[model samples]
Target: MISLGGKPLDIAAFEQIVLHQKDINISATAIKEVTRSYQFLQSFSKDKLIYGINTGFGPMAQYRIDDNDRKELQYNLIRSHSSGMGQLLSPLHTRALMLSRLNTMLLGYSGIHPETVQLITDLINNEAYPCVYAHGGVGASGDLVQLAHLALGLIGEGEFWFEGSIQKADKVFKKLKLKPLSIHIREGLAILNGTSAMNGIGGVNVIMAHRLVIWSTLLSLMINEMMEAYDDHFSVELNGVKRHNGQQQIASWMRAFGDKSKLLRKRHEYLYDKKVTEDVLVDKVQEYYSLRCVPQILGPIYDTVLNTEKVIIDEINSVNDNPIIDRKNKNIFHGGNFHGDYVALEMDKLKIAVTKLSMLADRQLNFILNPALNGKLPPFANAGRLGLNFGIQGMQYPATSTVAENQSLSTPMYIHSIPNNNDNQDIVSMGCNAAVMCSRVIDNAYEVLAVELIALVQAIDIRGISSKLSPATKWLYNGARSIFPYFKEDFAPSQKMREVKNWLTETDITGHFHKQL
Candidate 1:
C-alpha cells in the first residue's frame, strides 16, 4: 500500500494507485495534524469574519451570513454548483481526481475534518467512483462545477459509478458500509475549491504521453530497420555533438534497440569505402526527414513529458485551496492558491508535443504504404494481386484524418481564457479543458501508432526480412502478429486495428529501454 501525507506522492506511486489499483494508508502524524488544524479553525472563526465561514463566496463575499445559517450555507454551495453537464469522466480519471484531492487534504491545510479524508480513502480503495463530468470546469476558482459533482457524491446525494454502472451514492454507501461526509465547517468549499480536477487529469495525461514517447522511439527504430536505413543518423558520435539531453537519450535508446538487428546498414561500409563510379547512384544517400530525424523530432516531446510530470506532481502535493489553515502560524491566510495557470500551460505544451508525435507516425505510415517511396513493397503493401485486393489502403484515411484533428486540437487552451463568475474570475485558467483536450490528443496518437505498427509488420513480411530483425523489433512483430496475423487478402481492418490499439495501451514493450534512461 502507498502511504500518503508522510511524503509527497511521486509519479510512480500515483501510477501504481491510479492504474494498478493499489490501496492507500494515511500516516498517523498527518491525521493528528489534520485534527489540530480543524480545531484551530473552529475556535479562531467564532468572532472574526472569515470567508466561506460567515460571509458568502466569490462576488457575494460582501454579504454577511448569520451564525445559524452557516452550516446550511455550505450545503447550498455544493447543491447549487452541482450543475455540470457533459459526458462523465472515465473511472480511471475519476479515481485519479479522488486521489489527488485526498493527498492535498492530508497536508492539513484545508481545515477539513479527519472523517472527510477517511471517506475519500474508503471510496478510492473500494473502487466506488464519484460521477465527475467532463465539461463544466473553466479551471478557474478550482474547477468549481466539476468538483461540485465530486462534493455532491461525497454527501451521499449524487451518483456513484459502481461495478461499471451508475448507481445512487446512498445505495453504494450503504452496500459498502461507508458513511457520507458530514458538514463540519467549510467542507463544501474545502472540497470544491482546488486544482485537483485538472491536476489529476493532467497527471494521467503525462503518464500516457511518456509511454507514447517510448513507443514512438521504438517504432522509429523498427522502421529504420525495415527500410535498412543508414545507422549514422542515430549514432552516438552524431547525437553527442548536440547539447540536448533528450536528443542524446533518444539516440542512446535507438542504438540499444538496433544493436542486435541485422537489417541496419553502416554508412562507411556502403558509401565511404570507395568513391562512386556511376553518374546515377543505385542507393539513396539519405532517408526522408521522418526516418532520419527521430531524435530531433521526439527529443522535445520527451522533455515536455518529463517537465509536465514534475509540474503536475508539484501541484498534487501543494496546498491548492483558498484560506489555508496554518495552525503553526496560528493564522488563516486567504489567497488565490486555487488558480490553475501552471496546469493549464503544461497541458497545452503536452498536447502540442503529442500532436507532433502523431504527425510523425502518420508520415511513417504513409511512407511504408507508398511503394513508389520505398520501391520495395507493392502499392499499399498489398500482398494479394494488385488489382484483385487492396491491402491496408482503407486504413490510411482514418490515420491521416485523425492526425489532422489532433493538429487542430493542439491550439493552446491557456490563451483562450474568458471572464466568468461575474468577472470575479476575469483572467481565469482553462486548465481542465486543456487537460481533457490533451487526453484526446494522446488517445488519437495511440490509434495512429496502432495503424503504423500493423503496416510495419506487413512490410516486414512482404520484404521477407522477418527472420533478420533485431530481438526487440522481432518481439514486437511476434506480439503484434498474435493479435493480428499477416494479412495479404483484402479484409476489413477495423476490428483488427482496435485489437492492436488495446494491446498497445495495455502492454509494456519498453520496460527494458525505460530502465536504461
Candidate 2:
C-alpha cells in the first residue's frame, strides 16, 4: 500500500488505485495530525466561524447554520448538489476522478476527520465506484455536482456500478456486510471543493501524451530509414547549430535508426560495412514535414508534460482546504486555496501539446494516403488492389477532420469566464470545462493515433520497411501487424485503430529506453 499524508504521495500509485489496483495507507502520525486540525475546527462555538464547514455554500456563503442542523446541512448539500445530468463519466474517468479527489483531501488540512478520509479510501478499495456524470461541474466552488454524486454514493442514496451491474450503493454495501457512513457538516464541502475531476482526466491524458512523444520519435526514424534519407540532415554537428533539444533528440533517434537500416551500412567518409542488400531507393515523397519534424514538434510537448507534472504534484501534495490550520502559528486562515488556476492553465498547455500532436499525426496520415503526395506508398491506405477497394480512403477524411476539431478545442478555457452565483463565482477557473475538453482532445487523439497507426503500418508494408525494420521497430510493427492483420482489403479502420491506441496506452513505451531524467 502506498502511504499518504497531507503531504507527500505518489501519483502513479494513485493512478493504479483508480484503475482498481489497491488501497493507500495513512501513517498514524499523519492521522493524528489530521485529527488535530479536525478538532480545532470542531471547537468553534461562536465568533470563530468556519466558512464552508458551518455556513451555507457558494453564493449563500453569507448565511450561517446552527450546530444542531450541521448533520442535515451536509446531507442536504449532497442531495441537492447531486443534480448532475447527462451520461455519467466512463468507469475509467470516474474511478480516476475519485482517486484524485480523495488524494487531494489526504493532505489533511480540510478539517475533516481521519475517519472520513478512511471511509472514502475504503469505498474505492472495495470497488464501489459511484456514478459521476460528465456535466454539472463549472470547476469553481469545486466540482459541486460531481462531488455530490460521489458523496451520495457514500451515504447510500446514490447509484453505483459494481461487479459489472448497475446497483444501488446501499445494496452493495449491505451484501458486502458493510454500511455507508454518516456525514458531518464539512464532509460535503471537503470532497466537492476542488479540481479533482479536471485533474484526473488531465492526468490520464498526460500519461497518454507521454507515450505519443516516444511513438512520434520512433515513427520519424522509421519514415527516414525507409526512404534512405540523407544523414546530412540529422548530423550532430548540424543539429548543434540549431541546438534545439527536441530537434537534436529527433536527429539522434533518426540517424540511429538510419545507422541500423538494412540498406545503408554507414555514412559517407566512413568505411561501409558489408551488411548490404541494395534494394532501397530514393523516397519520391521525401516524407512530409510532419513525418520528419517529430522531435522539433513533439519534444517540447514532452517538456511541457514534465513541467505540468511538477505543478500538479505540488497541488496534490498541498493542503488545499480553506481555513488552513497553522498549528505552529496558533491560527487559521481562510483563503482561496480551492482555486484551480494552476491546474487549469497547465491543462490548457497540455491540451495545446496533445492536440497539436493529433493534428501532426493527421497531417502525416494525409501525406501517406494521397497518391499525389505519398511517393511510392500505395494510394489511400495501401489498398494493394486499386478500384475494387477504397482501402480506408474514407478513414482519412474523418481523420483529417479530427485534427481540425482538436485544434479548435485547444482554445484555453482559463481565458474565458462568465461570472456566476451573483458574481460570487467571479473569476471562475472553468477547469471543469478544461478537464472535459481535454478529455475530448484525448479522445480525438485516440482517433488521430489510430489513423496514424493504420497509415504507418500500411506505409511500412508498401515500402517494405517491415522486412528491413530495426529489431525494436520490427518488434512493435510485427506486434501491431498481428492485431490489424495487414488491412489487405478495404474495411472499417476505426475499431482497429482504437484497439491499437488502447494497446499503446496500456503498454509502457517509456520503459523501453534508459534515458536521463
lDDT (0 to 1) per candidate: 0.91, 0.71
Model 1, span 1-517: residue lDDT tens: 9888878999999998998899998999889878888999998888989999989999999999999998899999999999988889989999999999999999999888999999999999999998999998888899888889899999998999998899999999999998898999999999999999999999889888998998898899999999999999999999999999889888998898787899999999878898868888665789999999999999999999989999999999999999899989999998999999999999999999999999999999999999878877899888988989999899999999999999999999999999988999999899999999999999999999999999999999999999999887887888889988887777788998999999888775545456555
C-alpha lDDT of candidate 1 relative to the true structure: 0.91
**Per-residue lDDT of 254-290 in model 2, one digit per residue for the tens?**
6664555574323542324445445664443234677
**Which candidate has the top score in lDDT?**
1
lDDT of 1 at 355: 96
**Model 1 vs. true fold: TM:** 0.98
RMSD of each: 1.1, 3.7
